[model samples]
Target: MRDLHSNRPLVWSLFAAFALVTLYMLGVRTLVPPDEGRYAEMAREMFVTGDWVTTRLNGIKYFEKPPLQTWMNALSFSLFGVGEWQARLWTGLCGIGGVFITAYAGSRVFGQRVGLYAGLVLGSCFYWVACSQIDSLDMGLSGMMTIVLCALLLGQREGASARENRNWMLLCWAAMALSVLSKGLIGLMLPGGILVSYTLLTLQWRLWTRLHLVKGLLLFLAVAAPWFILVGLRNPEQPAFFFIHEHWDRFFKTEHHREQVWYVFFVLTAVGMVPWLGMLAQSLWLGAKRAPGVDPRAFRPRLMALVWAVFIIAFFTKSNSKLPGYILPVFPALALLTAIYLDAGSRLARVISAALTALVGAALLATVPFMPGMAGRSTEVALYQGYQPWVLVAGFVSLVGGALALLYARQMKRDLFVLVLAVTGFATTQIMIAGFEPIGKARAGTAMLPAIEAQLAPGTPIYAVGVYEQSMTFYLRRTVTLVAYTDEFSFGLQQQPELAIPTVPQFVERWMADAAAGRRNLAFMREDIYTALQAQGVPLRVVARDARRMVVANDVKQK
Candidate 1:
């Protein structure tokens, strides 16, 4: 394989292409339900209320996770305005930047081509690409973990200057600190645990001295502990909720109601890595093979990476709680392994990878025709109809890229083969993901916002009766009163009792009082809730309706 380092243009091109695909998708789709809208709203509230200490959801105390992501997101809003793309910019940048960082660290540790391949594998990996395009803490968490892992690898290299070693170790500690800020303590726990286990496995007690524990610990404490300390001080209940309930209880008990079968992550990581899973296994097997080495004290980067991946999967698997993103920290290590494997220039590996690409391309193409049939709802099917052409474009790009990869492998052009698949990754992400805008639109409840907004005059209190559309709170640019509806926000609402209207009767009484006081009120609820409201003979008039939600107003004349 030709050295990718010689061609600055090619490197820049890859970065540009990946960035464009990821950034373009940020604005194309409305923030989807639950996660996207939830995080974005959290950031929005932080920006609105100027309360960076205790993170809030729907104007209530939200203490499940730390505020690092929310802080970055709030910073984004301050810089770019309160738009979708702006909210996502931090996560998108982290994903793109993580690719380069992994490549840089890989090159420093391995060689140039291996580094390029590392970036290619990570940037284009199915799950990484998907995570990068969304506004989630996972990518941020993944990126930060990559930094910490890479720094540890780079610092522990065989023969670096003492100054260089200390600097790298310090950076590693700092990145771990930021990692804590990114998601929660797992950021430190996962990687730190990996380091301890790897050290024990290698029997390299001397590696401990290289860690620069004194300054590193101080640096980590300085960056990571402040927010927790401050937020806990401000909201006394938060320390218990975040440290105990969120981390410990979430791991030990399924009290949060997110328990899953033990093998879920195994399946998710296997499917998530997709075309690269075979290479990942191959890399691991290769790592486990003992090389003929006289120096038993030698440090092993692959061993470190393998430990990182294994520890994350094992720790998460042992926990009572699980999510798809919990396994994201494993990809960096897998990408590193694949890069090393690719660096060895295995024609057979390239051939197999290309074949997998072809299979995946075919599968993507195959899904296009049946998309409408797949969706049970007409609105969703209509979204599929509108989104079908772009899916075909994605399929065509992926197919062509795969076919080109096969030809490159046939001709022994491994560089072109990898490059083709990489571009296909970028294209698949851009087309297929951005193409889901219609679906996002449908689920986003944006269509119903206009009518809902019209009925909402200045200072008109809006009620989310028996339903909470996440994006609506952000769209309305104010917190909606929850009338007998608190799902995820129940914890926060519990902490702040005044923030919600906990019962249907309470809402009715409040609505009647507000109506009698000559204050117009509007409500958005599910169709079932609207039916129930009608059956109860609620005075609200239906102003607008969508497939799932209805907007009702006290004054029919406004509609």
Candidate 2:
């Protein structure tokens, strides 16, 4: 056990293996819709259009999010040809980088063992690992917020030199700026709120003096302001929509239709922690308590982490709109606190955590047979059936790993217990995420890409009739005209009215005119819409189809 903990080469090899797996997993799963496909398509448009100043999705102005993620993904596409992995490259790197940063911060503030465990905890966390592989704004935002967090901890910890404090605090501020760029105002607001809560709770008023406020604020603006300025200059409508509608309206009102019960985040926290659930409550409780012999006014990273997790969770819970990913930034803090607790906690707690993992695994194993029953459509039955084997493997691996970890804990093999649990958690998450490929493949509409591509020319008019498959835009390398559909694209459609046919009749009229002109017209629409159009005597020839959607052409003859 001692040798395992102290062996530098083995430790580094584990880190390298974990990193390689994380990067490899980026390409393993197809980009799933609303978030993953939305961002990928946005970046593809940016790369193709060469419009770095303004961000657009589906050839319409999209100001709901700041463009840091888009910019990064677009840059990824530029460097490497556009692909699923390329779209997700930034979020993956951010996730890996966050693990290293947290480890370094934990080593500095807590101890070497705590640092090692902290990295393992975060790197293997089900939620963190899962989000890392999925290309979404939350992971990107969380990654930058992780920097904002660790940098502050490094800067404010006791016994820091003046130069070290200054440099770290500067990094903290700049990261906050990047955080804002990744999401929106919550980037600055959440961290600032957490800091205030920490100060009020711990009475760490003197901590502010070391923040280098003047220099830090300047550095922040320098990194975060130019994009806002250039983008706002180019599109005057962005400022109002982004700052007011995106932030205030989304938070204060239920306009996005994402509201949920108050206990949702709490539930997510419990589930997201997975094998570590046994240690979570105790860790948070202990985190709020000051260590014995520590100075009353000294900087406390544990308390800071507690406040960071609590404040962000509470802040979002108060918002009328909520999502599973909103509380992602809290994972690093939780991992740190959990690591500290495991390093110094009771043997009973360790055993219980390991046992809980085994129980969860067993539970998952029992549910494998019921997976096919959960599918709504008959066609989805095969996908769910294909996924069952993967879940069975994951469950067995977790069950074995957890039992081994429990045995290690009972035998006082502390290092082995942690390593086994970490690897189990990571492997289980990767397995489940990769196992989702069959379902994701259907959702992404990638299977129809070859058929769809064969029907396209340089300027073939493609209409997204009553629906949009977010991934198709990127795969087809072209934008579709919105027909009688405007969910998230409402604002963008408002800006470019000419980009859409707002009503079914209008779309049908346009299709008739295009057919008369002998122009190739392709469309993607729901099965019901296809039926309705067929009933209306529209000249629609099915090019390709899945259970949920269909692709059709205006006429039989190719233009």
- Local error of candidate 2 at 419, Å? 0.3
* RMSD versus native structure for model 2: 1.1
Itemize residue pairs with steric clashes in candidate 1: none
Worst 10-residue lDDT window for candidate 1 reads: 286-295
What are the Cα lDDT values of the candidates? 0.83, 0.91
TM-scores of the models, in the order given? 0.96, 0.98
In candidate 2, stretches whose alpha carbon ends up further than 4 angstroms from where it belongs are 3-5, 557-559
For residues 453-493, could you state the per-residue lDDT of candidate 1 as single tens digits?
Answer: 76666888888988888887887788888888877777788
TM match of model 2 to true structure? 0.98
lDDT digits (tens) for residues 397-431 of candidate 2 = 89999999999999888888899999999999999
What root-mean-square deviation over C-alphas does model 1 reach? Answer: 1.7
